[model samples]
Target: MYAAEEQAKGKPASVPRFSASRRNFLLKTGGISFASALVLAASGCTDNDAPNGGSLTPPNTTAIDLGSGDTGILNYAYALEQLEAAFYTQVIATPYSGISDAEKALLTDIRDHEVAHREFFKTALGSKAIVALKVNFSSINFSDRTSVLGTAKAFEDLGVSAYNGAGHLISSPDYLTLAGKIVSVEARHAAYIRDLITPGSFSSNVDSNGLDISAAPTDVLKTAQTFLTSKLDGSHLPS
Candidate 1:
């Protein structure tokens, strides 16, 4: 939970920032390159891991409710992406000790991808988008490679499962399609991070049925709340 002073601040501790070159490119291309052609088509109007269960109601009255239906789902995703983007941004800002050049480059790419994903949801949702989330990463030690990679692995795996679980809840085909694309990218991230931890454990999390594990939104939110200062009310989310 955030302190009263922190809550009154009304801003995330770390907001993802893009380079000027990337910003200029996005402006020139109308963000099609990083966000995809679908973004231009609509202008565009649009649209975790935790335990394998948890309550949907927030822990406190000031919690941010995700609302109901598809819009609620989008907000849920945006919040997670915000958390990911913030985590990676901090990782890059303070490189873990003994970090190799190869590792740094790869992590930087992941950071950029997360930032792009975060921006995409924010743009698509427009007025419907929730406020930027306040993330709590004190548990992570940014100076240690083991700690950094471990957290990265957790976040990536959680993200993949989150999308898999939420897919059915999305009623819009366009939103579903977009979700599919993003999840695939997230899976790739998960695989890469897993391999980094263990040479060939990339697919270790897959089930006996050759499918990745999925968790309900309730479960995901329960775990996600651990790293978030803002309590989330998922009770109104689609069942």
Candidate 2:
């Protein structure tokens, strides 16, 4: 019933619940400890497993592999952040027609926040960070107000769910803490965008249990494909 109403309002649909492979992986690794400060709790892992810092090279074939373990989770997050940062950058660069001054400022703030989040993950991941991603925004009619806000709403909602679903997959307590902080910001973005699309939609995102829905990394990437030119490989991520 809630989903039907939300869909009727043209809001993002809730992700259907799936098996808990990601949840199981989290439980198994939550107790394991890494030997190195930069490596995952799993054996034979190291920071060197990732690309060089500040490298903007996109992978060939347009398919990225989110490797197994905690690094994979971070890469998954970094990928999403890159998409968001690129999106808001374009949004601010070319404001949608009839956009208000207040809206412009708010969008700019969102852009800055996304860029900061993207850079934070990059810095945190260091050598483990994936290369810069290439995005496809051909579907978005950036000049239209409805189109822009709608896309923003979708991205923000997906981000919140992605983080919530991946929460348990994170084995490191410190990393989990950091993710919690970021997800809270993402949730705020979702709420703001939702309200912009429909006044009083802030609560529409909450389920009957008063909890936000979560999506496995794979499922999240499936939706993200709309804006991405590259193919995402979340198969390697813990599942």
lDDT scores in order:
0.75, 0.72
The top-ranked prediction according to TM-score is 1
Q: Give candidate 1 regions above 4 Å deviation.
A: 1-55, 58-61
Cα lDDT tens digits for candidate 2, 1-239: 85576458653233332112122211212111211222222222343333322112234565777665778888889899999999999999999999988788777777766776676566556666788888999999999999999999999999999999989877677677767767887887788788888999887988899999898876788898778887777766765
Model 2 earns a TM-score of 0.75
**Count of clashing pairs, candidate 2:** 0
TM-score of every model? 0.80, 0.75
Superposition error at 26 for model 1 (Å): 19
Over the stretch 1-239, how does candidate 1's per-residue lDDT look in tens digits?
A: 33244336642222234542233211222123435433432233433222212357744678887766777788888888998999999999999999988777777777877887888777666677888889999999999999999999999989999999999987777778888878887887788788888988988989999998888898888888899998888877776
lDDT assessment of candidate 1: 0.75
Q: Per-prediction RMSD in angstroms? A: 9.5, 15.6
Residue 80, model 2: lDDT of 96
As for candidate 2, its clashing pairs are: none
Alpha carbon deviation, residue 23, candidate 2 (Å):
37
